[model samples]
Target: MKKIVIVLVLIGLSVISAISLLKTGEVRPTRVSELKSQFLEKATARVDHSKFPILQIKAASPRDLTAACLSCHNKTAQEVMQSNHWNWERPEYIAGRGIVYLGKKNVLNNFCIGVDGNEGTCARCHIGFGMRSARTFSYTDSTNIDCLVCHDNTETYAKAPEKGGAPEPVLDLNYIAGRVGSPKRSNCGVCHFYGGGGNNVKHGDLEEALFEPTRDIDIHMAVDGVNLSCIDCHTTERHVISGKMYSLSSMNRNRSHCESCHGEAPHADNILNKHMLKVACQTCHIPIYAKAHATKTHWDWSTAGRLRDGKPYEINDADGNHIYLSTKGSFQWGKNLKPDYIWFNGTAGHYLLGDVIADTSRPILLNTLNGSYHDPDAKIVPVKTHNARQPYDPAHRMLIKAKLYAEEKGQGALWVDFDWHKAAEKGMQALGLPFSGEIAFIRTQMHWRINHMVSGKDQAVACTECHTRADGRLANLTDFYLPGRDRNLLVETAGISLLWISLAGVLLHGSIRIAASRRNSKRG
Candidate 1:
């Protein structure tokens, strides 16, 4: 009984030791308050804009308020004028196309076509004033700048979409100007959140939910986590934003990267740390995009003009996202979408304006992410692959510019009359480019880089997600070989044959040893 008690005690002690070992190995989650204290402890602003006498006056127009601001900040407007935000033009040398000037004004996107003819509707996101109806607006005019759009702390200032990017008449300019301060999530989100047409349209990662995101939604922007603002990562120099658009910009000029804040070696594990050389920070950090809202993934222009009683028709998906629209055509939106992985360096190869179509049968690549495994600068990154079927001219062997939104109904507006030929002709005429007079729908795809709405480290994709699956996320990437995921027939057969032979040899040796032991026992 005493011996039994001793054995029982030993077993109990072993179980306790095992439990303690597990407890020690487990990592505890950081508290919200602790994380906030660590990352969001910023110094209070020194200069209050409300105290200034210039902001006290009742401003009649947005330009008037800008002029008042210029009285104190003399070079602010000039500095803004030099930025791509104001001019909407950035010149870059693309592969196969040399030194092409690209921007929102020049690039033909799947969404809303182009901004050439629809400046009034599209310029709502522009930072300047008097962009309505004028094909050539004055960029040098200092008064045309809208400072309240970025500086308004009151959140009362908002640009009217129909009013040519002007501040709403109901807005108290004096109150907004008095409360003028540095831009916040709300200030930037007013335009960016509602890009394309509505919320989560153009950029899959950017949405209104990022205004006050939770830790699970976006670790950096989380109210409980780092709570980083847009300006924190997109560090501006002389009013020019640092970040680069994959399709718009040729190279990352400002160099906003994960290493900017987090050092080169962020992960504690050696294996994960080594992945940083070939894998982008966002690839692992942001497992999925459009967490809060559904993002448009597909747009088919061929299905437009499905009307009832000579009027536009509309249809909605189960989640209430617009699946079909008479004005915009068909759309497919999804939430919590897995990103398309690609090898990308800083540079992008774009199909510039007037560039000839390479393959008429296959989907035209509007802009391709230029990179490979061999390229030292390249890394495997996550991107939102947006597919579309848009109008193209077979005769010209180029994409057709369709006038989507026009003031008059019969003036070659696809939205108004559902006439592709008239719209194509009008759009081509406006741009002074010759149209083939034959409009055909062609498949096209655009790769939009996913940089925002980052999830917590714990939510990152597991190794088995890609390393084990045959049709994994990285399966399409043929540039490099991945172990366990990729295989050669000879190597696989050799490995299997070696494993079987070793097992058979061990069994045979064990049988012989057992027979020898029996024989020795008989002799004894």
Candidate 2:
């Protein structure tokens, strides 16, 4: 009898081990298991979609998913109430309903009351906790940006199924939803890129630029060893998501970098700034480009000139615009005349601002000596040169070495070069733009823009719109702003392809399981 009991115990242990392996797909990593044990000693992984599911309530109704969430998080509710994210919607009396307005454009709110609020188009970003209804009801008057809104990844919640019950529950509810976590990309991208909506006077296209791979530009979030969430940089407070400002680090400012952290002044740090401590860092350390208007700080090229890409851009304006050209492979610029009017060819060879101009143009160049070039009356020379270089002129596009200086007087320039086609190729690679298709045009345009911005045209656009900023501003035009056929469709297609590929693999694996189960049963 004792021998029989031992055999039964061994068989039970084998079954347990087999179950764990099948469920997790690999023998759990020792470190991960240990961490999990320490954090959630009494927890289990919840697999059910219904128990802790997204409670989709209605938008017009008062008892909403948000209200339910606030029932437990009163302090967080206060924070949400004061946040600008909660006030994203506006009452559309013309339509006799409410509409979600992002940044300023109202027409772009696809998640309208007409769509019943719960539509995937609207619900993806505006969803409340425990939202489950076909039509979700949101508190229109209450502008509270709940903490749980974006951190709702109930899919990965792990807890002890028998003892701790349904994984921690989004709050402490009796639901068995999946565990969710803070966004590494998508959550922030939703608002950062204006829900990937129309190309209006918004901000840079963070949606497409956050994921691609390249080092064509620099921004605070794009710098290496400077990992921070959107909230960390954009928020007025830790939990607040208001007072939105363009992340200049992505543009070209190095003042907000890691090396500058804890220093008296970012641009004045002894180790980082190299010693021009008196000058306000942004005076010289400024953003090069981006689409969509933010402050009078961006380069406004909307009414400028036309490019090979069929869009209007500013011409190479005189003095205000620094005309960059390759002189002995250096990013050299014209001499600084009083009210120095420079017009850099947008198609000039790629180079850095600091490397080309060994001497900084000082003696206070502009009457409006503020850093940004976008001021309408910005007192700089206007660009009127059109298609300065013929489209596809191989000779006009060449590789040039350039250096960027931290301080005009003290710092030595950092050397870099520009290769138009190669830069475009590198940008495309970083952006994960399509390799074989009609996107070649977008790639071309994006390359030109990046070249223009880095060329330091007084009136420039952002490289991030086409290039991803995650890895040092990798300009990949093919991925973000394709040449023709509506760039939006290209982005959607890419996303769909990724989704379908993932789903297909999951389905195929499930099918194999069913077939194996059937075969084993028959053999038994």
Candidate achieving the largest TM-score = 1
Alpha carbon deviation, residue 482, candidate 1 (Å) = 1.2
Model 1 segments more than 4 A misplaced: 1-39, 133-135, 501-524
Candidate 1 least-lDDT 10 residues? 28-37
Model 1's number of clashes is 0
Alpha-carbon shift of residue 219 in model 1 (angstroms): 0.8
State how far residue 131 of model 2 sits from its true place (Å): 15
CA RMSD, predictions in order: 6.5, 29.4
Residue-pair clashes per prediction, in order, are: 0, 68
lDDT of 1 by residue, 140-200 (tens): 7899998888878888888887666787788888887877777889989988888789899
TM-score between candidate 1 and the true structure: 0.88
Candidate 1 C-alpha RMSD relative to the actual structure: 6.5
Cα lDDT of model 1 overall? 0.84
lDDT of 2 by residue, 300-345 (tens): 1111122335432332335333222221110112211011122211
